[model samples]
Target: MGAVASQDKQATLKGSEPSVAPLMRLVEPGMARVNALILEMAGSHAKMIPDIARHLIDSGGKRLRPMLTLACAEACGYSGENHVKLAAAVEFMHTATLLHDDVVDESELRRGKPSARMLWGNQASVLVGDYLLGQAFQTMVQVGSLDALAVLSKAASVIAEGEVLQLVAAKNLATGEEQYLKVINAKTAALFSAATEVGPIIAQSTADMRRAMAEYGTQLGLAFQLVDDALDYGGSSMTLGKKVGDDFREGKVTLPIVLAARAGTTEDRTFWSRTIEHGEINDGDLERAIDILRKQGAIAATVERARSYGDKAIAALAALPAGAHRDALEEVVLYCISRVS
Candidate 1:
């Protein structure tokens, strides 16, 4: 994208949407510690382990997952340093997932750069991912919070299961919104819930507080993923960090495609089958797909669904203590939805 176009998009993002800068500033100190710990933990005797790990970690991701952990802990009045360790662990887990996901999707780009798999080969990517997971577990063990460990461990398992579920659902026109929601809940929301919940767990907060954070994370994650799904089809590639229509090219049955397929006519369904299910794409297939999504109002419906989840996320914050952290967290949800809006 051109500088002028990027500037206009930034202006649009600043006008009505809540920026994440508040949240980033709120957790900056904890994030500094978390960043150092992440680098320390990612180290290994083998040169390739750090090499591959640093490649993706240094890539320009927002590091939102770990920041959630830090923010939640601070919001709950946590004083100890365990939250820092937990935040680093959250980042490691997220990085590992991205490594595995790139390999599975056979993706060439991540965050608008060549993916780790693309540079290091699939075998190296998978192995480095495994190494990171092991490091994450070790860091979690050091925290000495069994409950926090349990939450993250369960999330790891659910994320793996979600990936498998998505693999099964890919290219299947029969996939519905319900199943698609389930996939995102496991794949994306599980980690978010875990990342946020660990904050209250380590803070020794009340059950109500824990539940609130978990709900907030889950709803926020759903909203984030739904917005991402919509952006894949309707937004700019520069905003997405990956090429537009990647979901369509991979035949991933995201909510937008599910809604579009449901609202489409017989010929529309046939077109989806030919291009998405069968992968027999032609020169203008992507443009035609966008036309169909627009005609069926699938993109709008998906954004509405994301807005509903964003509202739920804000509601979930009612139980948390009121402060800058809480406000930042709420804004984070709005920020997620506003990318497409």
Candidate 2:
């Protein structure tokens, strides 16, 4: 699919976000090779996975996971075909998560398009997600790098854990920082850390270097998801793809709502426990949520937290030698804080 429509709106941070110009400039020959390998990874399946894969490949996500892999590989001085195969692996794992997530959340749209479940049916979507994960393992095996496989598998495990963790935490106002971190780390940061850190391992870099790059990816991933959660309440419904305030509507107690629940007035607490915590929101409940969120500064606080993670990502990059790839990584870190869609 082509790029989605962009309708401008006022925000605390909009165009002021960092540019991907540096990365854009660096998308030369090496990335082209990686892109070709991605096509190869989408192998033919007579049935089952292929049907769902077709819809998914056509659904038009930003291809951010694969792109991150390529960027990290280049940033860490990797100049090999491993980046392509590994990047495809990252995307497969991510796609699997989306497939499962839609089913779990009963979501109908993704990237403003019908979810796989909506178009293909639930069983097909779920099975295909499973197929992609299997495909990912196959992709990793082709590289013959146990180190890479180890990292990627661990990430996959964390992703699954995070999904289940979210299911458990939803509508529970008692979810605190440690629990929230557990969910996000398992759901978001794990893949990110795996994707970037794999580049170094594929390039046969030192262990310490891999550690730094992993930190960068983990922090960036956390930043990205924080903004995503914040947007669930604060951004335009259309721009957000999913419904506006869908978390509250679904009784998902994200950080913003969690903060409000923790610090709001007694009446607000009662409302939260009765409505969100109990999943009994009435018609006017969302507006009330907005009021409470604002009073608690949940939106602002979440954004600041995202920015802090972004800064940590940048700091992680300081250990790497200066280059265009590093610059691209930096741009992405900043973008995570401000992206509305």
Which model scores highest in TM-score? 1
lDDT, candidate 1, 1-341, per-residue tens: 22233234435544755689999999998899998999899888999999988888888889999999999998998988999999999989999999999999999889888998888899999999999999999999999999999999999999999999999999998999999999999999999999999999999999999999999999989988999999998998778878899999999999988998888999999999998899999999999999999888999999888888888888888888788898788778767877996
Looking at candidate 2, the ten consecutive residues that score lowest on lDDT are 1-10
lDDT per model vs. reference: 0.90, 0.78
What TM-score would every model get versus the actual structure? 0.95, 0.90
**Tens digit of lDDT per residue, candidate 2, span 12-87?**
2245655554565575465566556555665665564666765676665666667777777777777778788888
Candidate 1 C-alpha error for residue 158, in Å? 0.2
